[model samples]
Target chain A: MRGAVRALIALGSATAVWLGLLHLLFMADLDDFFGGDSGLRPGAASLAARHVKMWSEPTLKELELKKMRQSNAEWDFMGRTFLVLALANMSLRDPGSADKYVDVIDRIIDETIKIEAEHGVYYFLMPYARERPFMAKSGRSIFVDGEIALMLAARRIVRESDEYATLLEQRLDSMVHQMKDSPVMCSESYPDECWMFCNAVGMAALRMSDVLDGTDHSEFISDWLASIKRNLVDSDTGMLISSFSVDGQAFDGPEGSSIWMVAHCLDLVDPEFARDQYCRARQELGRSVLGFGYAREWPRSWQSPADVDSGPIIPVLEMSAGSSGMAVLGAASFEDREFLLGLMTSLKFAGFPVRRDGELKFCASNQVGDAVLLYAMVQGPVWASVKRRWNEAHVSSVGWVDKSVPVAAAGEL
Target chain B: MRSDFFKLPRIDELLSPRGFLKRAAVLTVVFAVFHVAGLREMTSFLCGMAPMTGGAAKLSALMGLGYVVSYLGFIVIVPILVIASALLLVSSRIWPVKPRV
Candidate 1:
């Protein structure tokens, strides 16, 4: 009996060590999987191939999109938006195969514009978007305007298009008009509800427009940032609240989904402030356990139920697939390699990636999830252009829009 | 024991360090069989984005849950059990529990 008990104890100890060893082994390979620049990144290539393949096969696209649309039409639409932007960035980043990526980007942009036109704006919006009338006269959602503008602007950056160029300026004008009209310089994403994520994207598009065109909105962008600092920040967390009313009242406190990319977007608008937000968000939301890093939807201080944005929170750990996945953007944007690697490991171990014949899809994720991953992988070029422009010159009081320099090289932005 | 080929191992024999390790290895093999039998596809429900459009959706989700549980066992629990049991077996062989406390 004594011998048996002793053996059992020894077995338990060995189990603990064995588990640790397995984790260590898994972690050792994360650099290859998540590192920013490796010579040949098959993961990005495989995922991009899968996305491009979906677009070419309409039936496949419809079937997969139908599944997501059944839950949230916004996802169905956002999936297309993210993929377009990723393809544009991919085109710029991988100039060797730019033609194929550009083809797919054009296809997606055309299809998305058709869908919006045919189905009307509400087709891509959530059901709740119709519950209360939008304050804006045209029944616009900042969500739609922001993403569509970014998509258009991103398309123009890789290669110039006269048609899209005109359309991009119009979208920017409408968004700017709405923001200037609102008390907080925030536009509605869902009727009365305005999202920082949408606003950030909207601002990002505005910034990009200035880059592509010799037009400046730095003062307008600056006022909006000032208003956010004064009215939109969550008192407890000091992070900007995720959503607010059109008139500027808080909807909820900081959320991982909204804040991560918001921080990334802020890098274009305000570098110092964006870094501050990223640091706060990282501290409040990020968690690592047993060598896997994940994020919580809500901080322990502020409580909100899991909705589409939050996804389902795994109870004890407060691990959220939604937040953790978006956190990939935050980590990658800030070059937080350690955290990025940890999250990437969790993704491989749990995301249930299915790779075959050089195409990869995470069985555990939907179209939006995969597109978001693609965005993180190929994000630097356009942002680099915007940052270069911001750093070179301060906003002139007269709103200087320099037109003398050749713009194709990206440095002139 | 030598004469009766049909007799099962006694509790003591099964509980012996080597016996425990053998049992764990056998269990792991069983789990690997289940994993290969195509249970991994069903595990996508764990991501909460599983398709709900067709009648097959719910049935598929139920099957997926089964696959996820089995896969988790195969990847996590089974490995630990096998390694633990092996450790116990080795320790027992190297240092048979002393007679005194």
Candidate 2:
């Protein structure tokens, strides 16, 4: 009895202590992952400083790009795009530091556009993009067009550029024409395929364009929203499916990686519906255990195979690196402070953050991943600007201010 | 004949544990070595770092896996072990373990 009692004591004590103190290892706050009064958090500043340094220093930048290119050339380009975007948003938030960020942004934009012109669209795309030709008259990838447009739009949002205005409009016109031309109003990223991720991004670019140029694509956008309602959502999960054929067949189910940003982009298109999607996704994909929060790639009801985007789901927890990275967008988009805090803490715990000479990088994540984190920390103001523009446009319009209708806010899309 | 980490300890010894302290010290030293050796950078492959070229890719992956495991062990498991041990000591002092039969 004495021996048994001691054994129980040791076990019980250890359990209690671990249960109590294990969370301390991951203690962090939302402020560190978000903008405060100063418009830059410590982690965000370190990350931005590191990227700015990498861009200014060519050899280090090449080495980093080469590693990413070997995996996916898209990621290489995406790293540039995301960083440029983060810088643009940062510039808006931090006017004192705006000039430095704008310089880096312009350099990245010039280099990116030049590289695409030289190497062709295939340079940044995956091998499968070449497997079949695009369905449009011009062999353009929506993946390229959408992101580049957003980069341009974001830059112009910070400080309007005459050069970028033409560039943004040219890209948007072609995309709008192509999307409008399609029977289902979906533009292709891959051959005969349209992704919710890319479409949402394309939509965000459109919304941002309206913010900048006073152009209205409300009819086009609302129609696309109608199409989304009719065809894009998964019935089983009641969340939007990820990809579809140009003719509007569901290609993939609601995915965490896709939905978080989808919900975020929808904030520009429709705030109430965006809120609805976010709440539903929070119900399905979001997980909070003990104190740490994570997101799973698929809802329990959606039977799907793991794909590249899921990024090696942890065995039983079903956490996806891809989804979790994008979940930052969701949490930030909705101002889910508690979830954001928990997720950032989990990131600090798992992301293998290294700080040297005031530079921060997550060792367990690559350039694109780090860029996404930076964007998460500083995403609000850009979207806020878009919404403000949207509200301004609709303030005098009849019946537009009515919040009673879900579709009335952004005009149903 | 054998070393057993999980072996039960007498209540009096647990109150001011030496073995537990020794284990914590070892973990700290090992973590220090890992930190100094720059194993943390190698762990970048855990996310998705690709090796530069042909034959080196496999080798780089192996090194990444090794670094990541050790890094996790050092940061997570070792701390857990040390804390649990400390808790055992604290519990011993609180209850003043009665002599085992």
Candidate 3:
């Protein structure tokens, strides 16, 4: 018994020392894990860079195009979107070559929009999309519409295009119409299924509206918030549910995989709400051990199965691919550098090998998975600039005053 | 009467450090063969990959537990055994086995 006790104490002491050392190393600014200064850190950028360089030459582009021709045409399209977003964020950080990157981005946006218009949104959406019509009367998906709009908005921000501006406005109008029609002011992406992800995309669209047209949908945003508080938010946790029925019935509870990025998107619509959700998520979901940060797909009490969205769940650790990818956006948005760096390190050590030639592929992830990672890396500048502009416009009487003045003048005169 | 049946190999040969190292090397090679053959997929049991398909929940759970143990044995125990054998060989060489003094 005495020997056993001594052994237990020794083990505990060693574990404490090991963990403390790891924390100290992590806190010491050991390396630029996010690839901010180091270029691409192994996760998504490598894969994207491979695709871009591969497609840069005509022969490689033809080969890839031919290979993807029969498979999910959506992968080809989404790959372009992911690459463009990655480049846009990269451009902000490295301004000397911003224009060159922006040119590629513009081409991608033009191509994606053309494909969607020609083939229709159904072409890119999953097979279940055709099984039942969209709940929105006009049959537009917030998923397709919001991402495309954001893509256009991202391109226009770098370099304005008249065509993109027009396209963004039309999509925003459709989204607004759909929102106004729903009693809960939430539009569904699939047959009665309203996903928090799609709602986030909707929020992104609203943000782009403020950016492109200088419109303040604050009242509409407020009403929607009230509705979400009433119906969508989980009562105990105060986190947003992953999905809901058209009538605002909760389908899936708050998911770590979805809510982290959703919270980042919510920052655009409602900053206070976004912060609250993020803090709750961080408290409930984010975990660190031995200086490595990983997230569970669900809270301890909320049970969920592994799906395409959550990717594979690592047992014992309960680390999730989707949540880990989305956690980047959350950590970066909140400036949780310690957590972000830890997560990045863990990703490098565990996720598939990263090559120097910029051919990064996670052994455990698929195409869409990598794309989301790329999105997280390059996300900040666009959202930051838009949020900054909104702050300035709100503080000053610039755009809002001019519109309000005409109505007041008409009343007075 | 049992002398012939109980006879043992020479202590000089059996306890030689070089002989121990040769055995350790053989074990390592065997472990490497299993590792490179993609038996690591078995480790997916620890990661909650399905152990049994097309079965009732109770039976599947039992099979899953079995797979998890076997997989952990492959990944964790095998590595430990190989490492221990190597350490034993190296220590014997360094200490000269003390000649049972």
**Winning model by DockQ:** 1
Q: Write the per-residue lDDT of candidate 3 for residues A1-413, one digit (tens) a residue.
A: 33233333433544455445544433423233354532444444556576567546768655544333333354465556556767776667667768777877876777778878898888766677789877777998877777787777777666678877888888878887887888778887777877887777777767766866788787887788888878888887889998888788988888987898788878887777888899988887898877778888888768878865675787888888778877877887777887787776656544433366547654333344456666666567767667666655664553332121244542332
TM-score of chain B of 3: 0.45
**Where in model 1 is the C-alpha error above 4 Å?**
A1-4, A28-40, A390-413, B1-34, B94-101
Off by over 4 Å in 2: A1-9, A398-413, B1-26, B51-54, B86-101
Model 1, A45-148: lDDT tens digits are: 88888999999999989988988887678888889888987888777677777788888888888888888889888998888777778888867888988999
What would the TM-scores of all predictions be? 0.89, 0.89, 0.73
Chain A TM-score, each candidate: 0.92, 0.93, 0.82
What C-alpha lDDT do the candidate models reach, one value each? 0.80, 0.80, 0.65
List pairs with backbone clashes in candidate 1.
Answer: B42-B64
Model 1 agreement with the true structure over B1-101: per-residue lDDT tens digits: 57765678776666565666666676677667766776565555655666456787887777767666666666776676666667766777887777665
Prediction RMSDs, each to the true structure: 4.5, 4.2, 8.9
Cα deviation in Å at residue A231, candidate 2? 0.3
In model 3 chain B, where is the ten-residue run with the lowest total lDDT?
B43-52
Cα-based lDDT at residue A367, candidate 2:
86
Pick the winner on lDDT between candidates 1 and 3. Answer: 1
Candidate 1: how close is chain B to the reference, as a TM-score?
A: 0.61
Tell me how far the alpha carbon of residue A17 in candidate 2 is from the true structure, in angstroms, after superposition: 2.7
Fnat measured on candidate 1? 0.44
DockQ of 3: 0.07
Per-prediction DockQ comes to 0.43, 0.36, 0.07
Candidate 3 ranges with C-alpha deviation above 4 Å: A1-48, A54-80, A398-413, B1-101
10 residues in a row with least lDDT, candidate 2 chain B: B12-21
